[model samples]
Target: MVELLDNQRTFHIQVKHTSLVLHVLPTGHVTVIYWGKRLESKSLAYVIQDIGRASYISDTDGIKDFKLEQLPQAMPTHGNSDLRTPALVLEYADGSRITNLRYKDFKVYSGKERLPGMPTITSGEEVETVEILLEDYLQQVTVKLIFSAFYEYNAITQSVVVTNLSKSNVTIEKVVSSNIDFLDAAYDVCYLSGAWGRETHRQVRPLSQGAFLLDSKRGASGHGQNPFLALADKQANENSGSIYSMNMVYSGNFQAIAEVDMHQNTRMQMGINPFDFAWQLVPQESFYTPETVLIYSDQGYNQLSAIYHRFYRECLMKSSHAEKVRPVLINNWEATYFDFDKRKLLSLAKEAADCGIELFVLDDGWFGKRSDTTTSLGDWQPNHQKLGGSLSGLIEEIGQLGLQFGLWVEPEMVSPDSELYRAHPDWIIQVAGRDPQLARHQYVLDLANPAVQNYLITELSTLLEKENIAYIKWDMNRNITDSGSSYLAVAQQKELSHRYILGLYHVLEILTEQFPEVLFESCAGGGGRYDPGMLYYMPQTWTSDDTDAIERLPIQSGTSLIYPPISMGCHVSAVPNHQVGRITSMDTRGIVAMQGNLGYELDLTQLSTEEKLLVKEQVVQYKEIREIVQLGQLIRLTEIENQNQYAWLYRSKDATAFVVSFVQVLARANTVPKRLKLAGLDAKAYYQVGERICTGSELMSIGLKLDKPIEDYAGQRWLVKKIEK
Candidate 1:
């Protein structure tokens, strides 16, 4: 037997019959190994614990028939159940001895760059040893992980659950979170508990160089495996970027979702921090905490605690007076491309308002010298050739149709030919000798420059002041290139990232405070800049540019796991999805978009009356239950990974709710339940929404069981709203 080195001083746990060593490495890798024939994998023994016993229910639509046989057998009733379990769970092959001695067989490595030499930073100290204090949670089964010195691995991990059983009072404080890297696992998901899911806010204690860890979405081919997450840090990242992640999980119910938008935690890491109850352990007592993280095949924040709470409590959770309705918005990129004008916009706005839209957003072309990617980004002035009048006048006209006006701006970018760029040629993030590469007609602005930041702030403020815009679609089109800046010295260039983000934060802070009511939605070329940082200022994020309904099922599905639908900007675009060229049915598009902060991104003026009426009806329906869809408990009724069959659910605390199930429908089989084993129903009660009443047992067992034709759409849903108390 070989004894492993406890060099990091991370942990020393002693059980009655075993000893465990937990340590972290310089590469930001953590190692947790048990000394005996480890009994890994969750067991039914913990059934007395919350996870094994927590009840589940749903009200979101689309689940009629589903089989439990396809899911993993683990009893993950509470916490983030979908995160990948470690390979450490696999013990020895033989069942011989319980272990008199021990053998070490674990090695997890993060990406390491063999730089010419280690970096010298004037900022702080070089890490020496990781410190961990372990106290067996009274031996019955609890371990408290008391750690100092936040490491890199902390950000990349979400699957850590430590049992606390110490006899004396012990408080674990988060001093620092590390930048750890992991090898992509087949499956990984970081389920944020409570406030952790979105609107990430880490008040003061920031895991530097970090973002909220939403669950990982693995590509389809590898069987729900998140290939990106499986990646250990690549050697290439050694010189510059530093990535940090935090596992902010809270305990108990309603802990998996956010209660509000922009509602911040004491910590302000995009307000994406998780919620939790303190584990007040007594003598021999134990508390179990499950954190959200991803290591699975595929899966997948804002700030202001008040705004966040308002969003949830006011907009999403309010079941009374027809959910106050965030205006149904329409963006024009999917509608007109580069071929629209004032007349075209007004026409679309008219159609949209008739169909119940409250806001119309003109994307990309109205400002600067832009027509296509070849020119004009920094000139914030209106493109007079394209605009018939002053921006404010056009905005007022759009508003006259009973809709709010919105516009797009990429303040952190500039076109070389733009007026702003010509005047401030030194503002771009580039070396004097290097020719900056452009993406979508723009070069990145050096926000790190204090002067540039002030200029952006002034221009942004002026533009808003002059316009009647109610919303701003703030966009960042590209990543940093050349990694060098004239504004930053050699040492300062390394500081660019953190400083750049700080600069962004400064710019948004000024604008948001100055214009408290204007809603700003962050768009990073669809998704490139999606991190909790941006969400702090802008509660919502435009998920991706590809808006096809069929394509969105997976995207929306994965996004829903970590972010509330309200924060995911899903829109119904023109039938020939400009991105994919596939024409999805309008109803199908509406249904998918309705699942999120619903809107239109299509040329509505072209729709037939029948389709227009359908859209009108959808708007009415969304207004009616947007609260239920946004605030209620979310559950996956169907297997998310199975493409042929899709299912999900949401519900209020009451027994009444709905489910949405999707299936192409093939040959039938009785082996699979035709209906749901609908959960969270009180076995003792009877529920009646109409003359017909359902016993809890019936709903729990058969769930209004029915068998309909495979292609039957309406047959897939079983809406059961409760009447009986």
Candidate 2:
């Protein structure tokens, strides 16, 4: 609900258990009065604070106790007596950067409105939006701060729209999507950081009296730094204390920053990276920033994550199958890398079908003259000779084996040695007179070009239209290096990073809509571009190329901090694992992979008879709990920081069924069995697990004991069903 007190000039936006209050002072400066647990009282004017200014502190317009630096502003401008970081920075045609913005007007709406040409939350009846317009009357610039409150999820989506209302052009140096200031710096900052093979490792540190940054300048949302930033009370745990988080709904070069002022007040902001970024807003032109999700929870990290999970599933994802069960398939990437014939794939598909797998994904090497990662990325045509017949014929044979077909394609990359690049060398992103750098023997396609967008949409649509393709593994194995675009002018060159993302989203929007039944799983060399923006187009993403079960413990846990299990594509690969070279038990691998959208990435035909039987049994078990696991409320049982053991629980929407995944990373000798406490269970009801009956209260408080033989990389899964009266 959004309430505006006309007499007090205060706006209160409430969602579920949270409330965000803003007040416009007599001087027309808007400030955040309060943001935290909901306030049920009708009067909120008393919440606004004016801590008298210090001796040397600068005040605004000679008004005593009215300093901009000390106030929590809604949108602060630079060089206006505010020494803090500004959310919006603009340079006018006169080369002047100073401007003072004051509250102009506001509008309260019933539903969330989409940001033009940007990925954002879907509009729904349960959501309310408020737009606050602030204008620099001197410079004739307008800034619209949009806030959408998701009523059921306790999430508020924020974005900014900047317009050049002046007669001359305005160059935007930095435009942050969202910013919030806290009264005290008494929290630990948590962010996800890692490299390619070990992506999304949770990192936590206490917020000090300086600026901290988490950024991605790799063109993609890079594997090194994910776009999630959080602040939790120093003593906060899984089930208690306050936690505030912000996640960007963008998959591009981005920045998330936390700054502590001299007064010990912490400010958090997130948006597209201002580094090497400058957007020229012509007269009457407007630029829209991507959405940033802001959530607050005094109930702890679990509650904060739950809000993001539910919000993404319902509001961000545009796929028709967002809430549906994803297919339990087997991707052939690890099984056959770049070497597979029609007969070879058929044999594998036959074995997979016999093992009860529902889908057979033919990964890489099936297109162009591509035998390896070095060639034929943009050439989407099926290698008819290598496949022994038409692509549709091979798919038909695989379908005859009782499995659906999925294909792998890298639409955003072009191999230098391929037909596509040879015919149009300028299609790649490169600057004139500069040698283009290559990664994985390929160049990033110039997606900012209209011709490139049309070509990808046409090629991908043709393939999807040809056969019974049930899924697509969209892969981008390389990050962009030569960031210049041949189609864009030199003045607009810096806009390439954001424009390319817009182009990618444009193509995905069309293709996914045309093939709504086909599930699209995005991959950027594995978890590189895994942000809410990609989830807006594809329902799931390949969690990581590192499929080693033991190595995945922290990766999956950190990813679950903001994303749901249904959004992670996890698979059991061959042992010794292709990436880590660590041999783990098949049971352990299956249990780890089953925590997400389960799949197999190993050669099924090569498994021994005993191993094949184990795969079959695992497939059957996954099917029994697939719906509950995919559509459930995930409650992380243990923090991944523990390193030794990490566990999580998934409770069904109705709370009648629960699926728990517990993994022990390292084996300890002569140690007692560990007891794990669970969450999201009905305390009054009894749950039955393999003939053992216990009340939910007993299971949660007393905990479940892991008495099995403990070994390195050992994992376990349990399903608890409610006992109906």
lDDT of every predicted structure (CA atoms): 0.48, 0.89
lDDT for each residue of candidate 1 in 484-507, tens digit (9 for 90 to 100): 567976534544543555577678
Which sections of candidate 1 miss by over 4 Å? 1-176, 179-325, 653-656, 659-673, 685-692, 704-719
lDDT of model 1 at position 492 = 49
lDDT leader: 2
Judge candidate 1 against the unseen true structure and give its global Cα lDDT, from 0 to 1: 0.48
RMSD of each: 17.7, 1.3
Report the Cα lDDT for candidate 2.
Answer: 0.89
Candidates in order, TM-scores: namely: 0.60, 0.98
Residue range with the least summed lDDT across 10 consecutive positions in model 2: 47-56
TM-score of 2: 0.98
Error of 1 at 416 (Å): 1.4
- For model 1 the TM-score comes to 0.60
Give the clash count for each candidate: 89, 0
